[model samples]
Target: MWSYITSIFGYFFKLQEDEGREKLLIEELIDLKLELEREEFHNQNIENKVQESSQQSECFQRTGFVTHCGESYILIDGSFYFDTSACSFNLNVNDKILYLGYNNSNEELVIVRILQNEGIGWENEDDSEEQRFDVINHIIVGIVDCREDRNVFIQGGDLKFNLDDVQGTFIPIAGDWLEMQCSIQKNDEKLTDINMTQVLQVTHFRPLRTKIKSGTVTEWSGKVGIIDNQIYFDSSTFIETFIPQVGAKIKYLRLIFNAMGLPQPKIGTVEEFQGQERPIILITTVRSTESLIQQDIKYTLGFVNSPKRLNVAITRAQISMILFCNPHLLSTDSLWNEVIMNAVNNNRYMGCYFPIEEK
Candidate 1:
């Protein structure tokens, strides 16, 4: 009897110990789970804060234009843009920098004060320009369509491209009304059919000389593919494009419209159609496309003097719609819907005769 009672007690004690061990293990598991959840919560909070801060980031953060002339860096993106002198820095290709030292200096993008990401990899901006023609720095080759009222062109080069005729700014129109001071030149002097001289001045706009493909012809649809890049004829040599990619102090800005609203243009003056093919409503007096690019800033507004001059200039916009408003006036209609038909019914002609009128 005594042995049986002792064995029963031992068994009971062993069972209690096992239960205690299991309870302890369960508590430990619960504690570990709580700790894991805490870590997750903390991480989520940090992420939320980061996202909030990023959302608050400014949309129109202005930066200075950068140019490297020898070892000296030139800040040339502003109207009164100049860097006290050519300041020297161990400038690299990519740096998310700001210029604060030159305040009230009339420079949009000024200094190297607040480097984003605390000076980490900043090469992301190099891939900004999407145009294949961007890398080709063209020189002012020749001037064309030189007459009394509109005396512009580089010289000798092809201006068969009606500045008022190109689907873009110049050829389709007279000019973009902007100017440039470019440094691109060709190696062959004999290739001097295009005469790019005059230091730098306001000139008509035209598209850069593109090596059109050999067996390609522009479809009525106005689409060109990569295979068609082999053979190129100067349509300007033939017809002409108004978007001047060559010779000028700078290229006009290709304005991208954010929405449906019209923005103003910087045409030196406004006028009626010069008997050209384009619509007359927004006809901007001929200007340089290069200079347009220089003037684009957030909230920048001006009127396009002559909507016809906007032929190539308006087409330069790659992404958004660029509304070329009147730099001087904001009339009800920025579009030339009336002129397209009026030329046909009424005897008023711009740059060239209207086919609609003939019909």
Candidate 2:
């Protein structure tokens, strides 16, 4: 009985193989019959004709319109469409792809793979953060608050910071940090009862240039200025500020005081400012504020560069000049006492401080 079963199984397997071959033959015969009837080729040795399906594994490259793409599949639109076996790309919703196909079935366009460093072209650099420079240009909406020496907090966005200050629909290109040494007319914002108004002319363009402090700190009593490495004020107020290097510039600045919620704080010491040599912008804050008090001392700061560091501190108001920011400037080195020092325990200034001084 076992022998009989084995013979039956063997017979069935051979039959199935014969059937598969027979089907292929039948299809070929039908196609050939039609071709013969149509007189396409001479006395055709159809059986001897090489079957190219076996050689379909030969790889080939082609360019075609991207008709469709699924999770891991790509259908190239062409005269003869093929399954993209293995490829890569940074394709958007409708990005065309160049496919490389090996065997007929083992082919594809792997987008994730192409987005990798080795796969993509020079565009791979956009993925790195070190070489990225993101510059944003916006109009001066308003000033939120200020620091002691010359750090002013500002508020404004949604507007483009363009060279021509033109408004229109445009695409946002990514970058690392902004590099600016130009000034625009500051009109409405008003800051008064503030010393170091000479700090009106701001100058900061690079990161290392942000750390700046004045020669000294003076009091609100008399016009403030420094002498002999000691802070001296009118009513006799003073703070020991960093004398800075011989050619000290606005490269090293320190914050004395600043209101919360406001990004760029005003009232700071210009530790360094390489004024005469190059233009380096210093971005202290990138925030906005809703609450402010004008009934008392308040100041705002911004960059100045009409030709070189033009003042944009107070746009439409009259203010007293107290501090000057120049990396290579000649100011007293004794008025470092006025640097405001208020630690922000909270980030949000909603119901925080209602500037009751304004009421």
Per-candidate TM equals 0.19, 0.16
Q: Write the per-residue lDDT of candidate 1 for residues 1-359, one digit (tens) a residue.
A: 99999999999999999999999999999999998797667644543443343332221223333432234344323232433222233333333334322221243432322212123233434532211101112223222334323333322231222233212233322333222212212223222122232111122232434312122232211221111211112312222244222222222221111000123233322223233223333433232343563343232333333354444444443343323323222222244444344444664444443345322
Please give the clash total of every predicted structure, in order.
Answer: 111, 86
Candidate 2 lDDT (Cα, whole model)?
Answer: 0.28
Runs in model 2 lying further than 4 Å from the true structure: 1-156, 163-175, 186-251, 255-359
Quick one: RMSD of model 1? Answer: 29.6
Q: Which candidate is the best by TM-score?
A: 1
lDDT of each: 0.32, 0.28
Model 2 lDDT-worst window of ten: 335-344
Give the alpha carbon lDDT tens digit for every residue of 239-303 in model 2.
33533323223221222111111233233323233222222233232113213223111443222
